[model samples]
Target: MSTTNQFQQAAHYARVIAAIARDRPVPPATLSSLHVIANQLDNAANFLDTDAPGPLSSLPIAATEALWLAELFAEDNPATRLPTDFTNYVLHRITGRPLPFPEPMFPLSDRLALQEVELTNRLQYLHDDTDMQVAHPDEWLRAVLSLWQKLLRLAEAVREDNSRSSHQ
Candidate 1:
């Protein structure tokens, strides 16, 4: 997978997670587990440039898979909720920036006001929703796979754009 593809995958996962979190009731313990998984994914992505195969190739998929699993387990365990703090932390770790409380619209301003609002709304929904479980884990996995493909493509585009700009 190219760097662009990786980024796109990462972005896609971020979006999915955000969507799942909305209008969902996540327990604190579950939130902690998700945070741990998110942290692992971040670590894996950081080591992608090393001599090894690098976790970047599979971290996003793993994270998404874990989330779906958690959702399954959530039926008997409503306590598996992800806290707002955990969600914010994961976003920060992945994007190298604080999670926007209210996600900003495209063409954002220097201030992250819009971003904050979006995040806040999502968080509220996640906290309030009663039915947050995944209906099909396989489908979720497939979606993540698609995101990974997109990430590779985006990474390539970024690299090419940079190369072209530098040569001019």
Candidate 2:
């Protein structure tokens, strides 16, 4: 995939995260689009790393976990779907998981704006670093896997919270 597409995908991811952070209702279409993008990323990873294609694979594993989490979050019952931002806040307030983003004290618009900027900046850094990845296939693999890992961790945190809430 081209770098432009990657940049757009990064923006899309940021928008989704921003919506989640604001606790705004994410449309079904948005979730579906995200699922598609996640699959594409997985495909790209698989194409790059063919030697280790199994359950024990490295990069593909992270992408697969992210894809599954995306599917789970896309379930019909929105109430059961937890947003990572909210999950982080709950964990921070109750369980001591650090809040990595800015405090959500501002108005909704302001918060969303700030989050979009922050996420975009981070993604830009990742994108700029991809120049090295181009020269080293291993670096590319690591970069993709790292991005997926970060995203998956957020999703996993939310999933865990959902499970805990359900049992209570």
TM-score per candidate: 0.24, 0.25
Our model 2 lands, by Cα RMSD against the true structure, at 16.4
Q: Candidate 1 on 119-144: residue-level lDDT in tens?
A: 44544544333233134423453343
Model 2 weakest lDDT span, ten residues long: 86-95
- Deviation of model 1 at 21, angstroms: 7.1
Where model 2 places Cα greater than 4 Å from the true spot, the runs are 1-123, 162-168
Q: Pick by lDDT: which candidate is best? A: 1
TM for candidate 1 is: 0.24
Candidate 2 lDDT, 52-142, residue by residue in tens: 3344323334434543444455343333233333222212222244433322222224444454455445645654564653455344433
- For candidate 2, the per-residue lDDT at 52 reads 38
